[model samples]
Target: MSATAISTDVYTQVQQFYARQMHALDACRFDEYAATFTEDGEFSHTPGRPAAHTRDGIARELRAFHEERFATEPVQRRHWFNMIHLIEAPDGSLRSTFYVLVVTSRPGERQPEIAPSCVVHDVLIRADGGLLNRSRRVEHDYLLDLKRT
Candidate 1:
């Protein structure tokens, strides 16, 4: 495939991967959510939080964190992506940068708070079947009380 075509293909695959991930989270499918990444993939929150290196590690940590943090109340979370820029690296890996708006709705809340809207920088490797996320970094523009704590 041409360079342009390869980039487009990779972009589409990554977009689908992200959509599935969001779907898993929205549907409260914690296991599936954790399965979206590679075995050695890393997910980083904002500036200070340490990156989780493996799916099992992240799942265990996030399960505890989410239950403790959100078990008291119900909330809805949605992640929206825009302006995705993809580049094919020399080693056949792909790098993508995009903007994401995460909105969370709380019970009895008048309006859902749109927060953590920022740029997402990611590196993905083309595997045998599909794209595997090698690294993901989320840079939040602003933080808000989106999740009910």
Candidate 2:
């Protein structure tokens, strides 16, 4: 498909898909978040870790990561996302570059502070007349050294 095929309606649907993705993640809805991806989706976030492939694999990886984070940090974490650019790939997929800001706040903290500003690259495909992510990768602006105690 040509770029011209990416009409306003398709664009709007893509945006909505992203919105739902962020909402699901923020709410810790792993199942819903996994649903945003295709059955054979892939996810890569942390360095040196193997990428999660398939919807079930994605859910398992996220659940383990979030559980570990919540258990150790004792802080509330929130994720905010904004689409910076959306391009139609030659294969008809939508390639998006987005900003992800993760905020962390202690129970009695004055304000929530940024944990990391991450750039996310996602390949979205049209499935069942809706957009679903085929692959997603994230790189953080800051070092994620959790052993800094």
List per-candidate RMSD values in Å. Answer: 6.2, 5.4
Clashes per candidate (backbone, < 3 Å) = 0, 0
Worst 10 residues of 2 by lDDT: 1-10
| Best candidate according to TM-score | 2
Error of 1 at 31 (Å): 2.3
Q: Which pairs in model 1 have colliding backbones? A: none
The global C-alpha lDDT for each of the candidates, from Candidate 1 onward, is 0.78, 0.83
Q: What is candidate 1's lDDT per residue for 1-149, written digit by digit as tens?
A: 22434546656788898888888877777678777778888888655667787988767766766687679988888889889888777788778889998888998998998877788898888787877778888877765446766
lDDT of 2 at 48: 66
Best by lDDT: 2
Quote the lDDT for 76 in model 1.
Answer: 86
Query: What's the residue-level lDDT of 49 in candidate 2?
Result: 74
Compute the lDDT of residue 144 as modeled in candidate 1: 44
Clash count in backbone of candidate 2: 0
Instruction: For candidate 1, give the lDDT.
Output: 0.78
